[model samples]
Target: MTTPSAEPRPRFAADAMLGRLARWLRTLGFDTAYDPAVHDPELVALAAAEGRVLLTRDRHLVAHLRPERAGLITDDAPLDQLRQVVAACALAPPPALFSRCPVCNAQLRPATEDEAATLVPAASRALPGPVSRCPGCARVYWEGSHTRRMRQALSRALPGWIS
Candidate 1:
């Protein structure tokens, strides 16, 4: 008999205080929305409209919305928060989520330094060979200290991940 296929990764919308978490989710290639000013009710509606899971720290908001596609944000730190979601969702860690743009929630695209010369800071551009850009927000990103930190955290949180 054939084994069942793994479920698709779940999408998410994060509340105000969970901005960092939302960004982390995006960094992990999850379609995560981070609207700091969005109210609980609006978040609920948007999550429903988009068929995304609501990620929030507010217990009342979760109870009020009660969306089947919802998950609670337990930890305060961004990495910890991601770990919680990953564990709760029973997702494969590491490469399962990586190299996504957090700001606009877009996948990162490869571009040569020459190609991105006009779009990135001189300091940033000078540091690397090629860079990645967010098609949705036009933000640029590359492997750096932040990536190391996040990788370390992912390691700590998901030791079982085959990486």
Candidate 2:
């Protein structure tokens, strides 16, 4: 049997049930579209229109889509769901961690120290590190304890993927 050629990592559109998984995928630098308000049919259409893989837990929905363009997520637990998607897609570690906004799904831009100081809480401003800001949500990000913890968790989940 011929091994399937590894495809370029796909962009994704996650159904409402996979919100957490979408955020994690975004955190890992994948372009994932997730809107809880988007109905299944619209999601399928959006995925098709945007050339995104549809990641869903609905068996019926998966059945309707081309198998090569969709993945059925079976796990209920968020972490397990994440692992399932990663494995299904053969995803690699993000080229840049925190490249996308977890809340709004927008790409993050580097924030100047002054901009970060103005946007972030005093505690976060006191930390010495570069920061990124989401242009859509205006949320500031820094390498604080929370980011460190998330990095640790991602490293554990993906193994040799996060640095």
Candidate 3:
């Protein structure tokens, strides 16, 4: 297996059962496609088209056509499911945390301070950090207490994987 620094992070497509895991993966800056309402066959086809490893908890999804890039998520809990994917995919440590939109799986872009300041409250504008905006969802983001909480969770989910 390749070491964390050597391997490129794998793109992923999670089945409906692994939606939360997919969000976490996106939060970790990985390209993760997730839709809780998509049908199984369409999900499989999407994964194939995107060249992503399809993470699923369904036995039938795995058995269907024996998809080469498919992986079965054995754990029911979210973090444990993440652990499985990290090990099975030989994932590299994420290069950028909080770089993708967890809700939409879109890469975030830097927002001008002036532009962001107009959106948040006067007190929030005083906080020091770059602001980001999701193109797909038009949601704003910044490093704050939520970042700390997520970092803590990732520390537990994959020890030594994040700072």
Question: What value does the lDDT take at residue 135 in candidate 3?
Answer: 93
Mark the 10 consecutive residues where model 1 has the least summed lDDT: 1-10
Candidate 1, residues 1-163, lDDT tens digits: the string is 0111354767788889898888777766788888888888888899889877788888888787686577878788887887788777765554644567777777778866575777666666566445787777777776566766876776676686624
Q: Which ten residues in a row have the lowest lDDT in candidate 3?
A: 1-10
Please name the candidate that would achieve the greatest TM-score relative to the true structure.
3
Full-model lDDT for every candidate: 0.73, 0.83, 0.84
Residue pairs with colliding backbones in model 3 are none
How many steric clashes does model 1 contain?
Answer: 0
Clashing pairs in 1: none
Give per-model TM-scores: 0.80, 0.90, 0.91
TM-score of 3: 0.91
Model 2 is weakest, by summed lDDT over 10 consecutive residues, at 1-10
lDDT of 2: 0.83
Mark the regions of model 2 whose C-alpha exceeds 4 Å error after superposition: 1-7, 65-68
Sort every candidate by TM-score, greatest first.
Answer: 3, 2, 1
